[model samples]
Target chain A: MTTLLTDPATTGAHRADTTHPSVSPADAVRQTMTMAWRATLKMRRNGEQFFDVTIQPILFTAMFAFIFGGAIAGDVGSYLPLMIPGILAQTTLTACMATGVQLREDMDKGVFDRFKSLPIARIAPLAGPMVADLLRYGIAATLTFLMGLLMGYRPGGGVLGVIAGAVLAMIAGWSLAWVFAWVGTIGRSAQGVQGISMMIMFPLTFLSNAFVPVETLPGWLAAFVQVNPVSHVVSAIRDLANTGTLTAEVGWALAACAIVVAIFAPLSVAAFRRRM
Target chain B: MYAVTTSPTPPTTSAVRTEGLVKAFGGRRAVDGIDLEVFPGEIFGVLGPNGAGKTTVLRMLATLLAIDEGRAEIFGVDVRERPHVVRQLIGLTGQYASVDENLTATENLVLFGRLQGLRRADARGTAARLLDRFGLGDAASRPISQFSGGMRRRLDLAASLITRPPLIFLDEPTTGLDPRTRGQMWDTIRELVDDGATVLLTTQYLDEADQLADRIAVIDAGRKVAEGTPDELKSSVGDSSLHLLLADPTQLAAAAETVRRQLGGEPVLTPERGRITVPLERADRAADVLTALRTAGISLSSMSVQKPSLDEVFLALTGHDTHSETQETAA
Candidate 1:
């Protein structure tokens, strides 16, 4: 054993003088893409990851169209327009919660320990998964709209408008995911992150105008819903999908998304660095 | 091939140095205060029971945990002030495998290589070569979830070696592996040193330190209690001893007297087991004592020369068994 280990050819030949180069902006982007690619491969292999964006959107859209369509909007036909945008907003936002849950799971499993020791940019691991999750949001948004179309709902906004609505929803989801990513860094476990995220998301999506028109809700409850950022997102998607026109709500939603990214991106990175 | 560069640079002389290093969780100090100097091209073993702060010290050095107090430097790079540079000099394998179970072995290696700044094609080529070198070529495409404990560990070690960093930290690398696999890991570590890398290895197993470490530090309660070579440690405990169990209980006194006359030392006798034990000045003296006992018409059940076990050395230094303490901390 000693003779084998002492063989210089087997050992010294592999030794390369590794230089520590300062991480540039371009390197950071490449490293983030590497991590994002890993996340994408994981999502592909894990069938459960697709269950949310695929089955949940299809099921929720059908359940809302059949169960609450006539009672809320007088028929399924009119409800498709209302429910499609609402479900798109809800499904995409809900999908963001998985980002935190998976991050926490990765941390608990000690995967971040390897990343923490690496010389790459600190933000790559946190930001990479969020970038990959844009695909989940895209799937949820597209499926919700397709389910709406299957139910005979037509958007006057044309194909371009519906596509615009899906893109907007996906962007909103990506921004919201940063909040969950922050929670993931500080949370004790995946289950804990999921619990906390669900508590925050349930009220944000359910109580907003995503489900019902604000006027029909009680005045006090309706007031809170109108101010909810999720309501702005739902209203923006409704405008884009229903009328195919850019509206003021889209500006408010974009501002909200920008504000979220600006605040939580640094917060998440800070929390991540502290933990390391 | 890289020749053995004998640069007398100060940084190359010491791969790791820590002074008064301390880490605490809440109000409890996990690593009270540690002082370590691991020179280049040598394997330094930190031997301790679980929760004795071995992992804590390694984690701090690896820059995975912040140093609450004191200082740590890796090849002259301050771990706290310039962590990125320290990271470039070191590779760390945590107590856990730390590899992604969801990803295949190839993917995990490629991902680490890319993160370390290798181009995509270079990363893939490195991954393939490492997989082959580590004997994982056939299982390279399989997800780590399907791997056995030993395979996962090999992959984890291979992942850390992707960049061939000058310094490596392995925290209980063979803690959960079987003996055969642990032997393989020890060889791998020795091979690393042969390639001109310095290693700081933390282990709870005493034989592991004796087998691999050029020097060992025995730590308990987050402090170093003893530091020496394995031979120095064993000799410090006591001289080697000869132990004999008599086949006939009635001949115990006769056998003790013969051992005393021949070996010039009194034999401690245990009446219940009909056993006699005598410390020897030289290990070869055991043969002379055995012949004298037989000449006295004493029949023995068994006789053997025994050196002090690490458990005895640990007991002499810390007044407790390391194995039990490890179990307590694990519990």
Candidate 2:
């Protein structure tokens, strides 16, 4: 055989002696960040992707706060503390659903076929976009708070507490996105992924205490709401944003987020590997 | 340019070698028990009609799909057991342009370069150099959405070459190109082999295989039917064949008889359409067959003589037409 390229960057054949040295955990993380950069570029080019994150949060925060303000709580000002955090959690989680839809859409493209053929980590394709999707959650969380501030709702817990709440919600959204990313890998088509993601997302968001108090529901339903992971996230956000303090609920929400990621991360990776 | 003695890996006899490689989708074997041996620095062509599982074979070897049975090795490395090593040893450009559509051409290349383990700065440098080499310098920063099909293909190929793997898999590299672009792609592929890269390309175009491949394997229904040099294959199918569309399909049987009796050759017949393709030893011999058919009152609607199509090659090698098999698969 003829000698291959002399350039060090192109000496792929020369490195063949290193048998089965799969990409290290560190390399996988680096590759995943590179993929996230790609996803960010896609998000920048497709501005329509931000419609849900930007507009939905603003609209939901205003509409839900005013419409249910009197019925759920005493008045609009009192409801602001409870409803604003609820809106933050709701918008962030909804934005998380887009992660799966976009993943499905991206995977449907021919570029993904090339990604699959590359020598990169299998998790790179699935996790990269989810990592970048933290931005969508960030935007949603911020917009919800901004909208709340505009509507005469003040955070008693101050700037630090508000930031913490937003950060927690962003983390929760990123973690839950693993569930949808899993759906993206297993779903038959992009539309199918969106449909399944919504079916899962809507129930998780609406059945929780995002817009209404869980105690008002029947005893059995209240028990389910207490266990609902989204309720914990919303409660945790409220505790931080209104009281400016960490509570057991915040710890519970963080643990729940970690559990979701731990369970679904492997599932998403395995599904992505088996997609073809 | 010939300063070549610092090789790290042992020299192998073949660039790509596979034995009884099988891939089944559900219950149907898309690539069943196929064997291939492609030497280094040669353009090995996988020629088949649509749905012949040519892409499936490429995907399996590229580690995009799992092999259902049998063994495949790239440059002496097992494909299934160690895909990471095999991936490092080869470059795969799929049937469609595989470059990211959302990014500009330069960004896409740099992305792949970084994915190839190049640092950020080196990835940028390599992207610029590859763009210049592929004649895509002018469109380097344009988003891939603005690219022509041929340009996207070039960029896709450039992405694969970032690591300069010894073996390259190109699945129908010029299937949808204009003739001018197809010629350009053919020149590019030839350039790869000259630079010590082995290429395995698949196509449904017999003319493409003739012009490019050092050796050709003709497959049908997931099984390889014939493998030989282009000259050996052409000798069986002939240089050109007369395609006659009969006025009345019912008289096809009679027309086949007249051609056989006059030319002493077998004809490929489509009974439903009353079409007959008769291989010719020379173009001048078309007169004899036409004269014989007219005398037998087997009037023709239209006729032309041209190079043998893949269908003709299939008929000559498999003794059955490819049109029926492709229709059955409906790909």
Candidate 3:
């Protein structure tokens, strides 16, 4: 076989104006957004799986509210505002695991290997998947709240308070996604990621006061529950929904969210940088 | 600019060059001290076996993996210093189809073009042009999962070429395809080279390397054993082979040992089949070998002399057959 070598002089003259084509930070951000959007679009094509987020949240929220509202509190009204926020927080965070699982799937299927070879942003694949996952969490959180409202769980918090509760939950979901992304990057397979993520999340969600008050627990358990980040977030949401109050606890919960993002965002990017 | 010619003149602006690249995983070296110079519009083949570190070399060249030692340059830009610049001038298609199976072929191509910074309309145009070029126009709307292996491979290749990158890395581009599809892919690759695009190809198929490579580099166990044109490497080990098949199944081992003792090299035993093969440098060596066999009373079922293949050259240099190992791993 004969391969014709192009005239370097011609290419040099043509590329002189181009100089060095480098991926600027702004371009990296744009590429990340584009990659994330593409990933979400692919997920939407199936359309069947979207119901997992939209319908699961609504069904789980309403079922948990009705089932627990009577047995635990003996009255539905007494727990509507309290339980809705807890359910919303719990449901959204659980949905965040899908982000890591999907990433593991992509890696196993060699999608990231392809991206590594392309002239795109270094963090596009990692950042893009995280960004796209926000949409899933957002949809799940919104549907849960709407179902709560339809079932007569009027948030004592006004629209602003309701938005604040949702915003906190959204940020919590997004921040938590970074941790899962890191796990997914290092985990061997999607099944391994699922097992590890579930193990990590089960303790966090169940140990926190998602279903009951922390004071009712044993002294040692209460100490663990109080320090748990999920408890802070749940308490913050409960405060917003039940009394529409932005207490010091809520401020602390926001700090915790920032802290998780601070730690895991860079870690996820660094881990993802080597995944290819 | 499009119709280039093969010339010995070194390009003043090389598309990509490597100097003593080295990479290792968990203390096992994959690419060790390989030097390559890829000029614009040339298809340079890195021909090696399954674990010869071809993919590692390609990955490092594409800036996917970091260099452990030495330097790599892409379009005059230092790869270690400005990886983004190196990435901009290159495209890569891995051994497997890397398309998102959930998306349609058209969607996959358009998305890739968009990632390359093409405008929405231009991305779509590029997608359409590529689909048409690869005979995937009609199936553009179908999800990639629904396509056959050949169709998926075509889409995969098309997606890589979306930006018309000046340099491309195609790692085992035609593995697992039927002969007809493989030929189609060859034509497509030739078209790219003809259009003044430089390509660096890596393959285990000797024919693939011979059919496409302007210069071939044969690697063994993370090191380059020999590097030259196909003819040069084949002729280096001579052009003939002498194969002996023992009539008595029990005598096969003795014959092989006898051949090894006479030839001063270990003869290859085709597993489970009763045959021993050795490289022949001259035709008269066959007569000498036959005389020795008669004196030793080694009976043969069949004996023949034929031209040496690239496989023989590979075995002569590496002491292992590439096909048998890959078949074992695949099984």
Candidate 4:
């Protein structure tokens, strides 16, 4: 040990050579994928993280279909078409809330400090877990449709249309997740992010046409629901799942998603950079 | 004490160099203008109390925080302009254990290795080797939440070495560990330096700096107050003193006079107890003073050499106890 300390050549041999090239764009993508894998492993190890997407979808889909079916649509079968798409949109959006809550939790625990010191891309930590969350959204969407099928609702759009509807809902969920990610970066604690996300989510999902037709809402309440982006998403899913047709509503929903990513992606990255 | 001065040109072998580096929060400077230089394969210790800007300066050098003023360079790369490049040349184990508690020990190390640009198979291989080296092989698959503080700290240190960067920053690496664990951490640091990695370590424990640092800079209130080798700093406090407690209280005055004559200085006499202290001009003079006291018929109950402690050095330099202030400034 004494000789090792005194001999500069032997000791310096372990020093990393700085002449190696800088990280390439391809390496950034790989690092992001590694982070995504970590997020997926965490979700798998902790079964509780799955409760929202799995059990909540089954329980809410049945509860909403049974309690409101008769009064709103005359029968459970008739309401499934409307209710399935609504529940799908609602559950997927709720699942995205976890992205912000978990991000805040991870940040508070100081893991990001290590990430900031690494040569990886700045967006890897922010975007990687979000990529993994696409799976959670998919699970919730699938369960909601499965529950709809068990309630005697048959879709005229068939399997392909149902698959399309699920895909569109997941894309919307992914895009909306950026908003929560931004909140995660700015929030002080995980609980704070959870509270703020819940407050925003309840109003966005409940006030929209997810539960009932906007026409049935009171005039003053309908005004807000008409402009809610969630309502357009639900309408787009319904058009694809119930009628097997892609309409202007789908285009509107996609445009809303694109706009959200455009605005919040840069904002989330900026806020994250400032804090680090 | 070395005066604080800016170097016109840092040496080519320097692993790290900083000039007038400053970081402020809410209009108050957390790190006042500071200058430092650390050479390759050297263990440079930044000794200061909590909130003395030790961690803040390290953070800027590691590219974890933006430098508000002046310049910081790592291996000749400007940290602010090319942080990614700087990052590639260094690894940091922060003041806190920054590993993911939700992930197992192996998982955490592998994740770090992968992020450091190791191939998948190579990452796994490195994780296994590090786990074994750190004596954490048996608990490799267990989540960090179940590990003790020492285990978590070891894992944290292991994660930083995944890339074996030429320079490493350790921020209070043993702040909350038991004495035995701190000893282990010291050995690990020594091994890292022996392997040719230049280390810049910030610590509040004076003994830690004395044991590990090749050179130490004593900082207080965001400014460096002293910089020197440990022995140099100790000697600056003057030669060791010879303290004597006489068995016969009536012989105190005689013993004081005898010590003064032998040491050629005024001896401090305590009246409450028969105690006399005299500075020894040289350590060999201790034998002469003891024999002179015995010949004078002043029997002694206890007599020992009291070398100046780092605590006294810190007190003399900063005018405050080392552990008095607990509140730290934001970085």
Candidate 5:
């Protein structure tokens, strides 16, 4: 087998492991991880905002704490507990955009089409990009907590709540990737993906009471914020880190996670299947 | 993983068979209803001009695209019903280079090997051997983006070979390659065929089709126009061609008319080039032509009788030159 680089998909010998004569889910996961790892290693050379993964979350958390802390809540110290969770949600959500932008770039360069021809699982291409986005999520989550600590934002719920908050943010980032994957596949160009994704996400993030209390807004806007999934996620994290309590908002936020996975996971898989 | 299962084994017959396969995009039929059979182990060439649906046919056979209508079977397993099985038995390299540009040439091969479910050590070993076999061992560590077009193409082909399938589909594999690279690729193909792999290659280059194909199918307007061995197709056009180069430009028409009157058939003449061409069943007509031309006292620059080329056969069957833009538009 070493004498020539025969396509493994061609050999019937490998068919035993494939799921029912097609590509297996396990095989697809491995391929995606390999692709993600390759893309991850590339950051070592190209050096395009690798630090931003960690730096942006920290900067945003600190900057938002100082800017909005004193004016709205009377002092930075009093608002640090409240503002930290909101800042974490906002920064992690914003970091999700990178997945869409990178996917668009790869598609533009004909990289996805190459994946389509391989006999691996249909979902590997999505897996690779989605998995690669996790590192960004991890970096963002870590730096946010570090900066919150430096600025005197203590978690009332202790280390467990802090860990729970980070894990929640990471899971959200992973689930959100499916939505970006759908957008990247459907958009015509990488630039188009960035433009469309920004348009959709900007209002979702801004209108959902990330920076201020919903009670301060008009009656209709407050009602909208109450139902916003981002609001539930942020409030849940706030409950965990600030009050040391697992509130109903945490249940709603976990349900929202389930909903996002249900809707976007199939959407991403279907869109990918249609494309190949 | 064990190969033995309680289920009955699949029946093996023709390596690839298609019946009335049809595919349409946006109300335009790319591959009209066509039937083709590619037996195992021989190199089959699908010869056509641009937009003749050769690639579409190959794609359907490779299980990349679904058949809009009709049935396709690989090794007697229906493509739609058992596409994964078909994929397991065949290798496909599309028209463009499809390797990961960020990875080294060896990395690209190894990635595909792992995707094919090879163990890490085996995939790496296979990748190294393929890199050496394709003469890219020294360039193995360099990123694929740094490789030249020919080098990238070789790597793409090498990736497809990472698993030795019984059948291979190559869609215009040599289209943009230089003459030397194209020849090298042909040699590689010949070697694979000799090792008992069936290859179905689509090419517009008549010389390539002539050189490698055991049998050729000429498709026009998404249908097979002619199917035969290269020699058979050429011979079907006629025995030989009598080409005349006239000394005096004005005498070409006169010479053609004189030959037609004596031979009872019209001879094609080009007054601009002062040339005349006629088809002859026997070579003895060359002597008769000289006698007639001598009696007429028409001067001749050159004259010769030669066997027909695939280009001539394409012209004779299609009524237009294969290289002409109109033929491409027609398809």
Candidate 6:
């Protein structure tokens, strides 16, 4: 306490107006990767965070296929192609939803306060967990396909188609996670984010051609199913995984994913900045 | 001027300067119209009760919270204008331990370094040195959730020092520690100043400010009541006083008489019939009062020797206690 006045090094140590610059684009990317590394570390410590991507994928795939196959398609074998891709889309959405809920929980922790006090890019903390979440989406997509294979369902698209379908679905899932991330930023609590996510997700997944085809619905219902981004994605997955065709549906799915990212990415960043 | 890439130029004599700083939550201003100036290389203390807005002031200066309706500058750079540059100049240890609970102590420190642009190997080296310095070497690999409160606080402080900015903000840095750990924390804070970092700390304990601060600002209800050396603040309030409770309410007058005989000033009576507060010139005078009360046939229930409470200090300095209904503004 006494030495502070005598010591010039400790007190008034500011030098020539350095005015260190804010983070650059390159530094923003680097900082995001570091935040991603932190998310992976958190995942390792709390393995339960993976439950939705793992157990839910297998459970929903098997339960939906066995129960709806015979009645909707006239035979379980015939239902495989349609059901598998739909399950893939559904499970991926579930995985993406967890991204927002977990983000809400993570933000409430004391460490996030420290992150705010640092000079890192504002979007790093929000996007880092989404980047690490690519694995969760991958797991959910693969398990849905594997479970289909074990149930004696074969895709005409074969190995290339399945891999391509999985990759496309994962990309869609990652982009769509921005919606949940935005919710996480705006929602008051983790449970609140989950509730709003479920409200949004259940309708998108259920009202689409995920479990049932579009033709079976009323005219107005079918029209909505035609435009619901989830249907485009499912149709795209079906083309890639069931027929090995990269058709217009695939393009539509990619365009939808791009638009979601373009809109919701900025929304998430803006809300996150306000929180800090 | 914004493009000039120098170190914000050595702050103009003041390490920290804030004018009319305010932070509002909805309708209430947590910190309202407060001004502060802290010289470089000094340990300046903000002394106040729990709601005195000490942390709010620190957070605004540290750039952790927005400064509403006022100007805050670190060195000479305006906080509102260049928060990033201000962040580069200051380190803040929040009241709660802000280290990651999911990470090991070493990993937490390294992660903080990496976030600040340190290379991996350099971060690891710094982590090892800090872990050893804070006496957490043995538990460096242990998860933070397993650490004791004192250990967690130490690790939190270590994380803040990883970059070692020239100015530090410590918000109630030792609120809940055993006496021994508290003493060690005070020593560590002194060491930081000796190494040449200007520190602005907020504390509820007057003794902590007396021990660590070169100057003190007494705050209450988001306002600075007094600013001076510790001796000046203590002198205005007399000194640390004595609080004694009698075993029998009937003995209160006799104990009061004994206190008056042993110490010159009239003892203050409390609402409680058996308790009285005796201000002291020196702490040793407490022993004289205690001995006189016992010899005067006054039985004691409990006794404490301490600095005037926030209430006591407020009464002495502003002629009013802190409770809202008891407030006598005109007086």
Best by DockQ: 4
Q: Give fnat of each prediction, in order.
A: 0.39, 0.42, 0.33, 0.43, 0.27, 0.50
Report the error of model 2 at residue B5, Å.
18
- Runs of candidate 5 with Cα error greater than 4 angstroms are A1-25, A42-45, A49-55, A108-111, A150-152, A157-160, A243-248, B2-12, B238-314, B320-331
Candidate 6 chain A lowest-lDDT run of ten: A1-10
Which candidate's TM-score is highest? 1
Superposed Cα deviation of residue A173, candidate 5 (Å): 0.4
TM-score of chain A of each: 0.91, 0.94, 0.88, 0.90, 0.87, 0.93
Report fnat, model 4. Answer: 0.43
> In candidate 6, how many Å is residue A152 off?
1.4
Model 2, B251-318: lDDT tens digits are 99899998898788899999998899987788889998889988988889999999777888888888
Per-residue alpha-carbon lDDT of candidate 3 for residues A72-188, written as tens digits (9 for 90 to 100): 667777767767777877777777777888888887775667787776766788778778777877787688778888888788887788878888888888888777888888898
How big is the positional error of residue B189 in model 4, measured in Å on the Cα after superposition? Answer: 1.2
Model 6: per-residue Cα lDDT over B135-215, one tens digit each: 999999999999998998899889888877678888888999999999999999999888878899999888899899999
Best by lDDT: 2
Off by over 4 Å in 6: A1-16, B1-4, B7-13, B241-306, B320-331
Query: What's the chain B TM-score of candidate 6?
Result: 0.81
* Candidate 2 stretches greater than 4 Å from native: A1-15, A18-20, B1-10, B239-306, B327-331
Residue A211 local lDDT, model 3: 75
**Residues A99-208, candidate 5, lDDT per residue (tens digit)?**
87777777655345456666667777777767877777777777888898898877888988888888777777787667777888788888888888888677667777
Candidate 6 local Cα displacement, residue B50, angstroms: 1.5
Cα lDDT of model 5 by residue, B215-286, tens digit: 999886688889989877767777687889999988876798777876666788888999988877777877
**TM-score of chain A as modeled in candidate 2:** 0.94
The sequence of per-residue lDDT tens digits that candidate 1 reaches over residues B209-299 is 8899999998888889999898787777788799999999898888888988989888899998999999987899888987887788898
**Per-residue C-alpha lDDT of model 3 across residues B34-71, encoded as one tens digit per residue:** 88887677788998878778888888887778888989
TM for every model, in the order presented, reads 0.92, 0.87, 0.82, 0.89, 0.84, 0.88
Q: Individual DockQ of the candidates?
A: 0.38, 0.27, 0.21, 0.40, 0.32, 0.34
Worst 10 residues of 3 chain A by lDDT: A1-10
